[model samples]
Structures are given as C-alpha cells and as structure tokens.
Target: MKSGDMFEAEPGSANRQEINPLLKLALELGPLMIFFFANARGERIAAAFPFLQDLGGPLFLATAAFMVATAIALAVSWVMTRKLPIMPLVSGAVVLVFGGLTLWLQDETFIKVKPTIVNGLFAAILLGGLLFGRSLLAYVFDSAFRLTAEGWKKLTLAWGVFFVFLAILNEIIWRNFSTDFWVAFKVWGIMPITFIFTLAMVPIITRHNLGDDSPQDP
Candidate 1:
C-alpha cells in the first residue's frame, strides 16, 4: 500500500524520483504566472525594455516569456531529477512550437489556441491509454496516493473527460472574449477550477485508497 509498492507495479516507475510537492507545484505554476504578468504589463514592460517593443503586443510578449520560462523549468527539473516529467515535457513542447509560430508570424491566434491544443492532446493521450488498458494517470499521481486498479481507472477516466471539457471551455472563452480577459481567465479561472475538481475527487480517492484503514467493498 506504500508509494514504493505502487511504483514497483508500474513500468518504468521503480527508479522514478519523487519531486517535492511544493517544488513541483511552483515549477508548474511559475511559468504560468510569468505569462499572465507579462501579458498584463506588456506595454509597460516593452516601454521599459525598449528592445521588446518590436514584439507587437501583450499576447506576443507573454508568449515569448512563457516559452523561456517553460524551458527553464524543464531544465531545472532535468538537472534535479535527471529525468523530465512526461506531462510537463509534452506541454512545454507545445508551448515552444506554438509560441514560436506566434512570434514568427506575428499572429496572436496561435498563442491563443495553445491551451486548446495542449488540453486536447492530454485528453487524447489519457483516453487512448485507457483504450489500451493503461492507467497513465498513475504516473502523475503516484506520489500522492496509492489506489486500487479500479480506482486508477476511474480517476483516469474522470481526468480525461475533464481535460476534454477544459479544451472546449478554452476555445469558447478565447474566441468570444477579449485578449486581456482570456489571459486573466487562463491564470485566474482555470487553475481554481482545476484545484476545485481535484478537491472534489477526494471522496473517490478515499473510497479506493489502499491504506490499511480504508474500507473495501463487500
């Protein structure tokens, strides 16, 4: 029922080093915060820097900073663990690609749609893994709790569907709203929604936990 036992059961997890929960969260959220900040203060930032004035506008400036921050986060993770976390790595790749296009073409549309692409990709990956009988969510949550096989399947299914919903929500918001509103929502709205959804899963996790005191169905 321990984390070690869960890792041993998962392929390629035996040697995985557990990242500190707070550090992991900071690494993930840090780049996002920078993105939001850069967007909100893009004009002021560009005025101060003078050199960044050529980047066009707030969204483009945010995209540039986001790409840089994501690379730094990945590099820090690699240096500390000698292995890149799968989900972050995938998201970082998308950021670099779409961010690059946004900058190169001077089009904010690419950057605006980046979340839809990333979320849709995650949803596809999770759902596809389920089709192949793999509960890949275990990779992300293994350090948090140990769950029964059925528990993992259910949790993974829930997350996969949630990702799909996020992708759609992102498309709706970005397409119908102003750029500033979208930037604020991406930072303020999405993270809180995800945090609430994670909290809501406590009952499911408690029911299927492999702890000694957890109840089992008859």
Candidate 2:
C-alpha cells in the first residue's frame, strides 16, 4: 500500500503541499504543551512579571495561553494550505466556541469537556457515514495507506469504535480525576494511546496489503 495516495496533495509540490504528520501533530499539540509548561512555571512567571498574579492562578494563565496558541496555529495552517483539515478544523472551532464560553462564563468545565464532545462527534460522523454507505474515515487514513476497499471498510469501523472508546475514556478521566490530571492526560495520554491503537491495526493492514505482485501501478 503506497502512502502517497491518501493525501490529496497539490501537483508540483506534493512533498511540501501536505504537512508532515509529525509537524501536524506538533501544531495541534503545541498549545497543550504550552499550557502544561505554563502551569508548571506559573509561579515563577508570576513572580517575575508581578501583574500575572491577577490572572488568578497558573492554570488560568495556561488556559488563556492555550487559547491564543491554538488560534495562532489554526491561522498559520489556514494561511499555508488555504484549506482546513476536517478534524482540526472541527476541534479548533469547538475550542474557539467553548474556549470563548469558558472565558466569558469564567467556568472551566466547558473546556474540560470539549474532548468528550469532539470524540462523540467523530464517532457519530464515522458511524453515520457507515450507515450511509460512506466511510469518511478514508479521508484521514487514505493519506497514510493505500489499502483495498475491504481494508478501508474494516479500518473505518475500527476507527469509529476507537472514537467511541476515546469518548468514554475522556469522560472517565475528567469525571474521576483532578483538573490537573485531566489536563495532563489530555496532553500526554492521547497521542501514545492513539499511536498504539494505530500499530494494533497492522494485522488487518497486512491481510489487505495489495502487494506489488497483485496490482500494477498506472
């Protein structure tokens, strides 16, 4: 399975047109990283700046900065590609909307539960796509693997289920854990769990390999 076809890359700049996965991850995760570090250094920063003490706490400062950083990232991506990624666009829009509510209402719960809403929406999109005889997950994984139709169907189902699982996990984390723990898990836990889940699909991927001997490239 060639990894090239999944990306709807522009001609002549196929390499540059599509953002690299790792860099994309960084952009998506950068704000959260800033939040975690800001929370960790809030006291020091407050001591140095003095005025930051009015922001209430390190956590508050972190959330404010996260909002700014996320907005910046989306802006940069929009500028570079002139196209918004489906998942990030959805998530970023939710962030802006809910982040605005959180700031406006001065209640952090809105931001805390944003993941739950996002995951639930993704699960619905994938599951509903299947119901409509469409596998929207293809748009995401297509960039990474050129699997056969059967592989795509199976993989899409797997992703749909995985998203449901993530929603449940997020619900549990936020419900049972402290705000700090939830924030930490949001940043550190999701990527590793997703990477592991992606690796776990290797067997199905192998079964639908679509090898060099099977089909000649046009």
Candidate 3:
C-alpha cells in the first residue's frame, strides 16, 4: 500500500533470479523522493518549464513526475526480473490511473488522496483474503522470510489494520492541512514511521519464525 512495499522477485523454484536489494530499494523509493522534491520546488520548476504551469499547480506537476517515475521503476523491474512483482505492479497501476485523472481534471485533490486509496485497497485485499481463509500477506512476503501459518495470519491482520490506519491518517492530513505540509509529511514523515513500525515487528517476526535455529541469509 505504501510506497515502501517493495516487492521481491518470485519465490525461487526454478530459474527465477533474485533482484539486488539496492536496486529494489531504488525502484521503490526513488519515485517518491522525486515527487517530494518536485513538490517542494514546484514553483521554481514551473518557472523554469513554463509548460508545467498549464498543469494547474505544483502538486499537479509533482503528480505528473510521480507517474513517470513509477512507470520507469516498473519498467526497470521488468527488465531486471523478466517478471512484474504483483504488489508494486498493483501500486503502479493505481498511480497511473489516479495520476492521469489528476492531470486530466486539473484537480490536485485526486493525486493528494492517492495514498488513501492505495492503503485502503491493500487493507481490503488482506481482509478479504482472510475471509476466504487465505493469508495473502504470506504470498507477498514469503520470499523474504518464512513463518508459521498462524504467524502469517497474525501478520496479515496486523498489516491490514495498520493499512486502514494509514488511509485514515492520509485523509486527515491532506484534507485538513496545506499541500506543503502534506508533502513534507509524505517525504519526511511516513517512511520513518513505517521503518520504526517494521523494526518493532522484529519481535513478532522472531516469535513466528518457522525455521531452524541455524543462522541463515536473509
């Protein structure tokens, strides 16, 4: 749901190749960084380009950049892996559609609320999977780590609820505050919060780890 939801190559079964961690990180975060920078320097950017002024405003400009960056990222992923990672692909598709609407309608609101839609979509997916007795989180994360079935269920629930919370938070911030403030929060705030939350999950991960005690490569 979040931009940080970087995908790994499919689970090793046959000839699938692994993606380099650094490359994956770049593909995941680079577009977001570009968007944030474009947003912060939008006036200067518009002044230089002039064409961007016709796009409506700084947020719109950033949205356009975000769309392009997302497409590039997905393309690079496909080139490196010869396959699209489902999660990132889904996120990228949302970016393209919502970003297109924002540009077409000249309404910043559509782009501003993109995260809310993304997070909510992920929450629904996870919860819907649970209803069907499937642990979709395990599918998304199985390549990264191993976990017991119960562990997968718990993790899926936690992540689903967290995603709902993020959707709500995005709605609150974007609707109630200035675009600059929202952009700053997206760039400076969300990643750190997500990183901290991930770190906090180490205990849960350890508790649910479904493997031998011997050290293994991540």
Count of backbone clashes, every candidate in sequence: 0, 2, 0
What is candidate 1's lDDT per residue for 1-218, written digit by digit as tens?
45433322342345777669999989999999999999999999999999998988988999999999999999888777767788888899999999999999998999989999999999999899999988888878877777887888899899999999999999999999998999999999999999999999998899888875543221
Q: On a 0 to 100 scale, what is the lDDT of residue 200 in model 3? A: 76
Highest TM-score against the true fold, candidate: 1
Q: What is the TM-score of candidate 3?
A: 0.87
Locate the minimum summed-lDDT window of 10 residues in model 2. Answer: 5-14
Query: All models: lDDT?
Result: 0.87, 0.75, 0.82
Q: Please, what is the TM-score per model?
A: 0.91, 0.81, 0.87
Candidate 3: worst-modelled 10 consecutive residues by lDDT: 4-13
What's the lDDT for candidate 2?
0.75
Compute the lDDT of residue 102 as modeled in candidate 3: 97
Candidate 2: list runs displaced more than 4 Å: 1-17, 49-55, 211-218
Candidate 2: residue pairs that collide = 6-142, 6-143
